[model samples]
Target: MEKNQKPLLIILAFFSIYVIWGSTYLLNKIAVNELPPFMLAATRFTVAGILIFIIAMMMGKSIAISWRQLKNTIIAGFLFLSFGNGVVVWALRFVDSGFAALEVSAQPLIVLVLMRILQGKKIQLMSIVGVILGLIGIYLLVSQKQILSQENSILGMSMIFLCMLSWAYGSIFVGKADLPRNHFVNTGYQMLMAGIMLAISSLLFNETWSSPWVWSSPVQLSVLLLIVFGSIVAFTSFNYLLKVVSPEKVATSTYVNPIIALVLGWYFLEEEVTLQSIMAAVVLLTGVYFINTKRKFMVFTRFFRS
Candidate 1:
């Protein structure tokens, strides 16, 4: 990579994680309305995993992994993808995409608490303030009578919160777990294992599986976008950016993504953007920004760099 070209690639990679990733909430919501969530997630990741392997082979990267690496990948895969992402997809059937995005924007707060509980890391003063603000924002967002009164909305919110816990712990786990050296290979193994697990979950739930040919055009397009851009391109860009930029810089995506998701959902999906939601977003993202101080930021870098 040339010096000048590196900068351009960096900008493009940031765009991928910020814009492309943010759009996934809407895509998943769109597809989940027509296709079963687990099946949709299963198909997307299964195809993406296979394509990643092919791309890796073409790039002269080996896909081979040791048994130990395989075991770790399965655990990471289940935690991060199968439950973390797939369950969120399921919840989207009940919650608006923008609302879901705002709720998930609290992930940094979750990670902070998890570190304290699991690793005995002391919470800093700034982070303590962040946590307080995050809790306030969450209460405001979830306490809306319209939201709470929606059928299955509470259940959906509860499940999404559980998924956040899974993702936060998965981050901590991956920071320490031994996995494949190549990030691409590691991601491929995780996605493949997660896809299989989601497939099994879909079967157990008795989800109806239909051929893509029969799916609505919007649903088909959404699935294709999720696989190609959401799963592969953005993920590749995320890893690329982590190598070239400060993880704090990469972590800015945490702040940008929900804003994009909220706007996109409101404009394209006609999802309501309530005043409370806007207020919650401001409070939540501000708290996340405070939580990303250098000392605390290292915790995120470890997981992302893994």
Candidate 2:
């Protein structure tokens, strides 16, 4: 943890949350095509949770938590993984993964607005501009005739939007909530609780289960990647970054995730990359940049006033 190494580690952590996490949309899209959504999600997380515990113990980390921490972890888990991630997985059944990622790029805007309402923080001029651009980008993306005309696309898009709210609020909550000191233990608890709930949800919805052995080669590989990198590595980075940086800074993963998803979807799955989508991605990520910019706005304002 030397000063030089810390910055490098932070950069590497950002890389994990950015590039690895960005690839998960395409991964989930592939896996969901062959498996039931909730069932797929249940299996991925349940196994990942178990693996996390095993790894944490092997590393000589204590996984103990008080009841209050357990309860809060469950709440955060449901908000982040169960509803936020699971519904997005479900929605991928209808919409293309790249398109879904494009829509989700507005996460910073949602987070910014939530901070304003919940914390009584005023939206600064830069963030206000970001919000306006985010809205325009979202409207352009979702309002496309081609997208809206697809069966269940609207439903899928609507559910994903709700999931974004859950994720945004969860981001805000986890930054301030009492939780386990070890990021590994905290994430392990969250994943375990979230997985159990997702398993119950899958059963309640009557989704059929199948053995991973019978899954297609591509899907099996995708699930393995989702479990190893997406759930364990990337999410751990996410939890760590939440502690080390601003929540909105951690959320900047949304900025790069869509681009990675778009290229992977188009190259691997032959998913369409429409012109409108590209335009929307540009506007959306630009707004995300504006929202994350820290102090230059105030400096510029002061200069103008002077």
Candidate 3:
């Protein structure tokens, strides 16, 4: 690819990651209405994982890895996909998809804090401000929901928070672990391991058989979209973005996804967006901006001071 085309491809990849992944929140909402949450996630990921594995094999990618590397990958996969995303899918049973997306949008802030503690990195002043702003945004997002009426809301939100932490921790682990050189193969293995973990957990939780064998077309379509576009395509694009762009730029999807989810939720499900949600969105975006661009902000601050 030419240098010019590289930029275009990166942009396209970012766009797909933003839109397709964001839409999965709404899809999860639709899916869980019929299928059980854990079971639904298990099926979606298992299918996506198998497809990715087949493609990786056809591409002559080696699935073999050192035992240590395989162990680490499985651990990361269970933490990130099985627990992190699994919690979000499970929470959609009680929360609006848009709100759930907004909740997970706080992952970047969580990551910064985790990085500080785990890697001994300095936390910038702007990142501190971002976390403050993000908390306020989260408060506004869930304050009015009927879901909050139950004790389960507290439990659900706690699960979502843990999910964020798990995902952040997984990202850190992935950065530190030694894995296969081929990204596709690594991702395929991770997804496969995560799918197995989720399925096993679903069985343990007695979430295995809640529904009829009959499938609804809407739910089936949602599952297909999630497997093909959300998991396979969006994840591939995201991996590509990590190579071509700055991690900060690729990380901007954290900010973009909630907006996409909110729009889709409003349009498709007629979910109401209040002034509070708008304000929360602004605060959340501002927080993410400050967190990601803190170095640039500090540079400008020092330049002006000089």
- Candidate number with greatest TM-score: 2
The segments of candidate 1 whose C-alpha lies over 4 angstroms from its true place after superposition are: 1-13, 237-252, 295-306
lDDT of each: 0.85, 0.89, 0.77
Candidate with the greatest lDDT versus the true structure: 2
In model 3, pairs of residues that clash are none
On the 0 to 100 scale, the lDDT of residue 73 in model 2 is 92
Estimate candidate 1's alpha-carbon lDDT, on a 0 to 1 scale: 0.85
Local accuracy of candidate 3 as per-residue lDDT tens digits, 1-306: 225435555667878877888999999889888887888888878888899989888888777888987887688678768998887899877777787788888888888888788789898787889889988887877786554774577777778889988977776676657766666777777778888888898899888454434768888899899989987788767655544444445567887898889999899988777788888889988888788875543452231121
- Model 2 TM-score relative to the real fold: 0.94
Give the higher-lDDT candidate: 1 or 3: 1
RMSD each, Å: 3.9, 4.2, 4.6
- lDDT string, candidate 1, 130-241, tens digits: 8888898899899998799999999999999999899778777776678887778887888899999999999999999999999999999999999999988887676555
Candidate 2 local distance difference test against the native: 0.89
- Comparison by TM-score, 2 against 3, better one: 2
Lowest summed lDDT across 10 adjacent residues in model 1 is found at 297-306
